[model samples]
Target: MNDMTPRSFDGREYPYTPQDFAAVSAMVHAHSGICLPQTKTMLVYSRLAKLVRERGLRDFASYIDLIRRDPAERQRAIEAMTTNHTKFFREDHHFRQFERDVRPGLIERLDAGGKVRMWCAAASTGEEPYSLAMSLLGPDPVEGRVIAGADVAILGTDLSGAVLDVARRGHYPAALSQDVPLDLRQTWTRVSGGTMAVAPMLRDLVRYRRLNLLNAWPMRGRFDVIFCRNVMIYFDEPTRERLVQRLVDQLAPGGHLYIGHSERIGGEAARRLRAIGQTVYRKDAA
Candidate 1:
């Protein structure tokens, strides 16, 4: 077994050198704010190996050369490296807080002819945003009537077009629906065979788009709630700080920000956002 070669599950070894790993790391970091430490070497190899094979590339080094010159290939490379590990109510406390605290005001705002918005910054496969929609809309049909026709929008964005496509479809394996509250499941999801689809009423409130967090945001208005959980762990400190500030800027006064349980806000944004709950921050109302 060559130490430099990464062996796949099928016992195929891909030639992945430190130099190749570094090159790929630099490229990924430059395009996306994600930091790729040496620890992720095997992960990088495993994910990109298929791409390398599909393009008939000899090795990661050659694949690196191709990505440098080809914008499209570079994008494919970034997509391959992106981690989209998400599930319905993966962090339940955040949703509970949103449901018990932030959502009521949003409902009131909508009832008074105001528009309400929520953004899922790293929506992976639709679960997080769909979860948000379900929570915001609620399970009790009578209490949910106000929001059922309200002008509320949920924007789910991610860097990967592939995952965004899955999110737009609003379908998931039925087993994953277990995390959804039983009442919510009955009201908002349709189970068929081994798969489930978010109901059209919930789906209609969501819009999926490809958004790079490092790039300029085209959104004009502030959001009442933003779920950017579990995404900043891959970014370096400086990148994470800048991103926190940007997230705060997008927040409407008195709005809420939800992040990964393991993550924290730093720099100026930290001062502006008060820690209201576990991994939850709230901007003071103006």
Candidate 2:
């Protein structure tokens, strides 16, 4: 890993070395708690090289230097390196589990004049929270809080402002809406300019905010259902474990917690949470 290393990627010249990637890995992990493995050198370069060039820097080393000198520039690098891969009902089974067990149980509680809250902790582009909205309340006004006789709200938060902006817009490419069920689509979205716009009712049910899970959480209430999927894969064991425990702290008694299909709760979090389905756990009523 010399300073002069040069590699061509995606038809562009990148003067990044192994050292540069390692520095990036350390920086992002510290900033966002996302561990970028060494294997993603090419992917990292491909995603960040443009930002380097945009900053009038010649290479990764230059960008790293800027981050070292100017803390503000580090946020740009964090934004560039963070991955936000998500889609509506990306894991259909989780939603199905929601409909089968979580929904019925939660609605029963709602019927008993209880307030139920849901958090899509990694709500990328609004799909997941909107899906929850469609589930808890329906696609229109008729089935909302006015008629449901319960307090229901969805808080959708993400670390990326870029994606949060998109989430607030309630619009998406038509292809991204393919997984949406036909009935739900007709009820919740209207097609325009080859994109689907979420119904106002559905939008009304969700609040989008920019939040870093590694930082302080401003949310003050307990949630009955929490969806924080496909995010912990990037965090190391310690960070993941701590995050799981924090999530557990945000849940009401017997509240459900869902993680990515590949993630598992360990240590005390595991002892406190009861596994209910594939990648789904519920806080024990202890």
Task: Tally clashes: model 2.
Answer: 0
Error of 1 at 105 (Å): 1.1
Clash pairs detected, candidate 2: none
Worst 10 residues of 2 by lDDT: 139-148
> What's the residue-level lDDT of 143 in candidate 1?
65
Best by the TM-score measure:
1
**Residue-pair clashes per candidate, as listed?**
0, 0
Across residues 54-116, which tens digit of lDDT does each residue of candidate 1 receive? Answer: 886667778899999999999999999998899899889988888898887888888899999
Per-model TM against the reference: 0.94, 0.90
Residue-wise C-alpha lDDT for candidate 2, range 60-124, written one tens digit per residue: 88888898888778877888887788888778888888887877777777777878889999997
